[model samples]
Target: MAFKYSGSICSDLDKIRVFIDEILDKLNSIIKDQDTMFDLKLILNELVINGVFHGNECNNNKCVRLYLEVIDNIVRIEVEDEGKGIDYDISSYNSAELKCCGRGLIIVNGLSDEFYVKKNKVIAVKRIN
Candidate 1:
């Protein structure tokens, strides 16, 4: 059986991290690897932040959906926002370039085994053995 967890939260910056942490806390029981835990935390943070700030524009009324699923060693994460999606093209940004912001997608793409965007939703997968 696959382990799954999902919830939606308002576009509140302060609350997003807490919600992600709660989900990760539950995932920890299933995933057992120090490196995998760290990578998953980073990936989840990047995606959720984008969903709340960029996608919903910090509008409290709008919500961001967070979803996670783990099957064996493979883990899939999905974040969707209640807003119009942007024209996301990860290929345009050079990963090496230094920037304070707008690097989340770049980071996610590099770390995840698979990454894709559909409308206002971003999905990433990583394998933890």
Candidate 2:
């Protein structure tokens, strides 16, 4: 069996965090490992917050879509937004000074087992049993 979790945030960071916490709570049965749970939570939070903050530039009226799917014991999360879209290319940034103002994506990249970005959507994935 599989499940899908999705929601839209009012361009508000707190609301977005709550939106994610709700999904994590629902998936608690499968995500019992604290470390795995923390990683998933933090990664999703950071990416979603980034999409809402930098991608959409904190436009409260604008909405961001978050989708989480469980398949083959892998929790795949895709956060989508209709903002200006990711303008920068992390690949071009210098390795020595690669950092963001809020350090949101940095935390996400560090925690996620695997993650990637396409346009304005950032995908975070984790495998759990």
Candidate 3:
């Protein structure tokens, strides 16, 4: 059976760290690789922060949904925020442009085996082989 977990958070950034750790602990029980765990942690952190800060704009009224699943050795993560969403393309973020502030998606896209954005949501997939 596939392991699955779903959680929601407000716009508070402080809660993010705790949430990440909780989710990571659950994932760790199923995923034994240190490298995979580290990468997953990074991916989750970046996506959740973006959802809370950028997507929800630190508005306490808004919420961010986090979904995680492990099936067939593939880890799937989805984060959605209650906001208007963004229009920037991940491909447009050049590493050379270090001064920009929208590099989170760029890093996420690079790290995850497959990732995409839908409205105010980001979906990322990574193989844990």
Number of the top-ranking candidate, with lDDT as the measure:
3
Cα TM-score of candidate 1: 0.91
Note the Cα lDDT for every prediction shown.
Answer: 0.87, 0.76, 0.88
Lowest-sum lDDT 10-residue window in model 2 = 86-95
* Candidate 3 per-residue C-alpha lDDT over 42-72 given as tens digits, one digit per residue, 9 for 90 to 100: 8999999988888889898988999999997
- C-alpha lDDT of candidate 3 relative to the true structure: 0.88
By TM-score, the candidates rank as 3, 1, 2
Give stretches of model 1 more than 4 Å off: 95-101
- Arranged by lDDT with the best first, the candidates are 3, 1, 2
User: How many residue pairs clash (N, CA or C atoms closer than 3 angstroms) in each of the candidate models, in the order given?
Assistant: 0, 0, 0
Model 1, 18-104: lDDT tens digits are: 898898898788777989999999999999888888889889999999889998788999999988987778777765787655689
Clashing pairs in 2: none
lDDT accuracy of residue 76 in candidate 1: 95
TM-score quality measure for candidate 3: 0.94
Which pairs clash inside model 1?
none
